[model samples]
Target: MHPPTWLTAFLDLPADEFDAAVAFWQAVTGYSLSAYRGEREEFATLLPAAGDAFLRVQSVESGPAGVHLDLHAPDQVFEVRRSPGGLAYCLVSGTESERPAPTTWEDGNRSQVDQVCIDIPPALWDDECAFWASATGWELVQGGRPEFRRLRRPARQPLNILLQRLDEPDGPVRAHLDLSADDRAAEVRRHERLGAQVDRVHEGWTVMRPPAGPVYCVTGRVPSADPT
Candidate 1:
């Protein structure tokens, strides 16, 4: 089954400048915070009604702070800790967290979507398709697939969203998705139960696959370190 649409995340800067940086969003989107961290936090809410979009300011880190993803929620809370009024993130707070593969759903509003597809090596086509399908229990495009494309919409999300047939795994791919496991063993066992294949092992970084064209990477690091 696909993951429920709820929250979305954006990263690239440090926590210190979030309040200041959001000025750009405020200027462009023309929408400002109604709730959330307000003027003192790294992340703030655009509207309490949506309650899922977040702007996470990466702190002390440099060079592509990591991923920018959206999560869905009716509760209207997407936690990011690292700013003026820093409260530990729920995921980082050692609270019960659910392990989810990249998931999405269609609310019939394409403009409202926060997830997108990226390119992958063409050779990974079948494997990537197979892997994601089995892992999330979703279906791949039956045919007429695009080359190096990104697909969204929960009703239709490609396991390997993009495909481009290149040399063996280049650097970490342009961008990669994140997966968090409650604990290392639990992460491994749960993914394993879902038919995921672990390719590399680390105290925290764990690369795995559901079936596979391109190997999907996951990290079972501590709560705060678990970037997804």
Candidate 2:
């Protein structure tokens, strides 16, 4: 099957912190807010001023705040069938919409969310990696380090999938988006100005916390032209 065309990186925040989380993300990504969704206004799409939305923020009833991916396909059941081993995912219909082309912000930084990294416990690491590989039709390759694995999508796809094996074997699964930037340091500074705290720098990538949101990374990579 052909891979899906749309991908959304979702930030699941604690119910009380939703507003702050949305504000922080909007400032950092320079995206405008789409109309709020859900019964209690628990969902919102973070749309780039000119591009397809690859990010969203949601308020969850419980559990630690984290991230997940929403892959839009013509047949939701087909996509779900690709995932096995109890991966936490759902298939929703009628959620697709048109998006504008991507544009760069005044900071001279064009950001593209090019990767989604799933934090998997040791026991489930292999299975999870395999599932993502099957679901995306992406090749599973070893990452730069042992603890990391990557599901590299075809060149045409907008995002890559990564599986990071965590040392802890008994925690909830979490995910994070990796933004590729032309100038890593400058982008990090820009995000800092928008209320993101630098948690630490690993290798050359900067790990950041957006106000009350979960952590994500800024890496030194050329932003892909296709923003969706």
Candidate 3:
């Protein structure tokens, strides 16, 4: 009702978070899979009496890795393009969220960001957007805003995630996590040569500050990959 859903997938990653975690864990422990592979490098979907719950989805090259995620509705195996640095797909949870609200990492570790969020609810936003279009690698960024369905991100890390309004409805999580750094675009141009601002025109990332708020810093996006 306020701001939870595992702190909105640990700050960001919604927009189709693995189709809201494999269509709500296969409609609550029904189990199902098979239908993923444009190339296939990673895949997961299980319930096993609702315990070892699974939902992986991997296969990156031109996209994916910032903790990849994708979820929206009906239509699987294809059609999830938008994250070409525009970033969006992050967060999924209908009700399962009891781990968030915590942070502290400049190398010290001590984390939480809700351990990377996911909560479902909103009527399972169309099979959780087909398990977030195969766990994000499905690619898809630069979305819309015909008012409000959800979109408030710097891709988490001090940033907040909210998009309530869509008729409102909640309940479903089970588990989730995505936070990333995989050498993001040379860290977004090394934060635009150190000043920070790398926009790249539209559907982009990198907007540093650090003094304490507004930080999506990956400027020039990493290069050799190593948030160290």
Q: After superposition, how far is residue 148 of candidate 3 from its true place, in Å?
A: 18
Per-residue lDDT of candidate 3, residues 129-160 (tens digit): 44443343233232343322323332222222
Mind giving the per-residue lDDT tens digits that candidate 2 earns over 45-112? 88766645667788999987877777777765533332433445544442444443334778666776
What is the clash count of model 1? Answer: 27
Q: What TM-score does model 3 achieve against the real structure?
A: 0.24
Better of 2 and 3 by TM-score: 2
lDDT of 1 by residue, 1-228 (tens): 224332233433455444444453343223456444435443554431222233333333334334333433345354543211121222221121222222211321111112323334544555554543443333455423334333333422211233233456533323344443334565455556555678888555566554322233454423322112
| lDDT on C-alpha atoms for all candidate structures | 0.37, 0.74, 0.32
Report the candidate with higher lDDT, 2 versus 3: 2
Write down the lDDT that model 2 would get: 0.74
Model 2 earns a TM-score of: 0.84
**Could you give me the TM-score of model 1 versus the true structure?**
0.38
Q: Give the 10-residue window scoring lowest on summed lDDT in candidate 3.
A: 219-228
All candidates: CA RMSD in angstroms? 17.5, 3.2, 16.0
Q: Sort the candidates on lDDT, descending order.
A: 2, 1, 3
Please give the lDDT score for candidate 3. 0.32
